[model samples]
Every structure is written in C-alpha cells, then in structure tokens.
Target chain A: MSSADLRAISQLDEASRKDIAQWVENEMAQAKLRSTIHNFTEICFRKCVTSIGTQTLAKTEELCLQNCLNRFLDTNSAIVKLIQEQNK
Target chain B: MAFFGKDSEASSTQTQDVKQRVMQEAAQELAVADVTELINNMTKVCYDLCFPNPGPILTSADSKCTEQCSKKFMAAWNIISQTYASRLRQ
Candidate 1:
C-alpha cells in the first residue's frame, strides 16, 4: 500500500473504520460467492459440452445453466431466511 | 440577541461535509477496485477457458485466444445478468 492508501484509511475514526471494514468484508464475501457461481457454470458447461461437435451450446445445457444458477441462489437465500427465522 | 447553538450547527455541517467526502471517496475506490478485479479475473478465466493447453511459449494463436476469451466472457456476463434479472421479477 502507498501513502495515499494510508491517508484515506487514516481519515476514518474508530466507528467509521469498523463500518468501512465490514462493508469491504461483505463485498469480498459476495464477490467470492459470485466467482464460485461463475466457476461452477464454466466447469459444468465444459464437462457437458465435450467433443467440440456443436458450434453452439446445446439447448439442454443452456437450460441446465439457468436452473443451476437459480437453484444455487435459491439454496443460499433459503438458508439465510431460515437463519433469520431462527434468530427471531 | 445572542446564540449559543449557531456555532454547533456550523461545526456539524463541516463535519457532515467531511463525512460525505469520505464516503464518496471510499465508494469510488471500491468501485474502481471492483472493476479492475473483474477485468483481471475475466481475462485470466477467459484465457484458460479458451486455451486450456499451450506450448512452451505463447504464439500469435494464443494471442487470439485471449481476445476471443474476453469477448465471450463479457457476452456471457451480460446474458446471465439480464436473464437472471428478468426471471427474478417473474
């Protein structure tokens, strides 16, 4: 990190520092979540689209990608809601 | 007439301006970092996806691999985001 980085970071008070840290942590966690989703799709399509026979993706594999993406999000959201309910 | 709270309001506004500036700067840094990261990751992923194997040294063919990979990765991101957003609303 450079002096500019230290300047920007040092401007924050304790509460502000904590708030910014949490914000960054949350964004990074979400970024990782998204990267994993993308990787999952990339690998799945590669596995299913073997042989290099078709120039375009198969309709079924496309559908599978759609379903896979949603189901993954659905799984996460469902868990989140369940946890929220438990906490209440 | 005398006023005791006027300076407090002035100081509060100055503080508010500082807070706003800090927040804006922070948001901008995060946005820039996110964009650069996305581009870097997309480049790497696209390269691997398009050219799984390479020789000891990359040739002109490998250069095209990187180009095509970026184009397709962007297309995929656009399609996926749009498709998901529409399906999400319904």
Candidate 2:
C-alpha cells in the first residue's frame, strides 16, 4: 500500500479518478481474499501434513486439508452466531 | 482559431493514459507484495517441517524434504483458495 503512488491518482481527471477508485476497491477485495487463503493454507498445512513423506500429497492428507478448511469456516460462522446470540 | 475544444480533448486523453498506467503499476506492486508474503510464510512453515533439528549445514535429505514440504504447502493453498472462493460465492 505504501508503495503505491497516490500523487498520480490525485492528478487524474474526475472520471478517471472514479474509475481508478472502483478498480482499486475490487483489487483490494481480491487481495484480502488471497491473504486469507494464504493464512488458511498455513493453518491446514500444519494440521494435516504432519509428516513429509513424498513430493505429492497423499490421499488422506489432501482430504484432511479440505476438511480442515471447511470445518474452520464452519467454526468461524458458529462463533459469530454465538456472539450474536449473546448480544441479544 | 477554435482549437480550445481540441486542446481539452487531448488533455483528457492524456489523463486517461496516465490513469491506466498508474493502475497497472499499483496492481503489479500489490502482486509482488502478495508473492513475497506467501514466500515468507512458506519458508517458515517448510523450514520447521523439514528441519526439526538445527544442523550446521543442510543435508540432501533435508533439502529434499524442504522441496516436498513446499509443494504440499502450495497444494494446500490451492485447495483452500478454491474452497474459500466457492464458499464465498455460495
């Protein structure tokens, strides 16, 4: 974010500035998604791939990784739901 | 004598070009940053997985394990990306 040249954006015309704003918003969302995936991958990799046996992931290891991701999301939602209930 | 409109038109076009270039540069910078972060995380995760004991130098076996661990890490990333994207869509 600090690397970006904000001065250039300010010099743009109104229309061009609006276009850039929309494009940047989309890009930021995508970037957030990518970072989230990176975090989830690190977590699941540690949990699932306990040992490094081969270059390729074993069947169980792959399944475990997928399940770990799904369950993690489920857990996230469940916690949010619990918080909402507590507030109400 | 009536070149004022044409002058403004050219300036607008120039502005458009500048905007496009700025967007491209910003996008490239962000992409590079993302890759750097990913590599940093991978290094930490794989190093711990591959080298349980600290040795003076990396042996061939440890090197191979590091390679495999990186591959598995990337695979896990792909799976998570796909799963998360689909879930977001749903």
Candidate 3:
C-alpha cells in the first residue's frame, strides 16, 4: 500500500482499523503459504520426475514426489533443532 | 457526541466503503501474484524437462512431450499441495 493508503486506513475507526489489519495479516500469511508450496512443488518435480513419457505420473514417480516433500520438511526441522541445541 | 449527526454518519459509511474496496483489491492482487508465480515456475520446469535440446523448429514429438510434461507437473503440484497441507495440520 502507498503512504496515502496508509493515511486513509489510519483515518478509520478503531474497530475498522483492527479489522483491516487482521485481514492484511491473513492475506500475508496465505501468500507465504502459497509461495512455499510453489517452491516445494517445483523442487520435487525436478528431483522425482526425471522423464516425461506420459501424461500421468508413474507410480514410482508419484511416491517419490510425496517422499521428497516429506523429507524436505524433515530436513528443515532437523536443522532447526540442531541450531537451537547449539544455541542452548 | 452527536448520535444523529448527518455528516458523521455519511463519513462513517464512506470509510466503510473505502475499507471494503481496499481489502478486495489486496485480495485480488495477492491471488494474481500467486498465479503469476505458478505459471512462471511451470514454464521453467516443464521447458527444461520437455526440451533438453533446442531445435530449428518445433516438432510434433516435442509438442506432445510438452503437453504431457505440463499435465504431470500439475499432478505433482496437487499432490505436493495436499501433502504439505496435511503436514501442517499435523
């Protein structure tokens, strides 16, 4: 939003201002979620689907995509945990 | 405070209308951004998978491979979305 938009929002009543703030927060969270999913899908697709022989994914390919997503998340948390432990 | 102030009431309504319009615009902008990212990512990934080598002209086989690659890419996206959502719920 522009600074002018911010000034307009600030002119709103307290309740209206709170509602708008909440909505903006929700929109931001949703955008982040979408971006994460998009990145994951691209990464897993590249790793699992080596060949595009058919319109439908092969059984192994589907399983690999699922496994790839799960492992990526697992790796994320595992690294976070190790970092937290080191800080302690 | 003037509970019956005509000017106050009119301005309040205007404020509400403005708020609604801004929210709607923000929602639409976010949706468009998400779709733009999806299309760009799809094009890059599918192009790499379907066309490993550049050709002087597009061939039927290349076209067919591109079609199949796009479909499979969507399938992968759906599966990944579901898996990610479920994991978040857990």
Best by DockQ: 3
Clashing residue pairs, candidate 3?
none
iRMS per model in Å: 9.1, 6.7, 6.3
lDDT by residue (tens digit), candidate 1, B30-67? 66766676676666565556567767887876776566
| Chain A: TM-score in each model | 0.55, 0.91, 0.88
DockQ of each two-chain model:
0.13, 0.42, 0.49
Runs of candidate 2 exceeding 4 Å displacement: A1-5, B1-10
lDDT of 1: 0.56
Candidate 2 chain B worst ten-residue window by lDDT: B1-10
The predictions' CA RMSDs to the true structure, in order, are 8.4, 5.7, 5.0
Reference-based TM-score, model 3:
0.87
Candidate 3, which segments miss by more than 4 Å at Cα?
A: A2-4, B1-10
DockQ of 2: 0.42
List candidate 1 stretches off by more than 4 Å: A1-65, A74-88, B1-13
Interface RMSD, Å, model 2: 6.7
Q: Distance from true position, residue B38, model 3, in Å?
A: 0.5
Which is the winner by DockQ between candidate 1 and candidate 2?
A: 2
Per-residue CA lDDT of model 1 for A1-88, tens digit only, reads 3454435445545455466567657866766655554565454444433323333455764566566667767787999999999999
Q: What is the lDDT of residue B73 in candidate 1?
A: 51
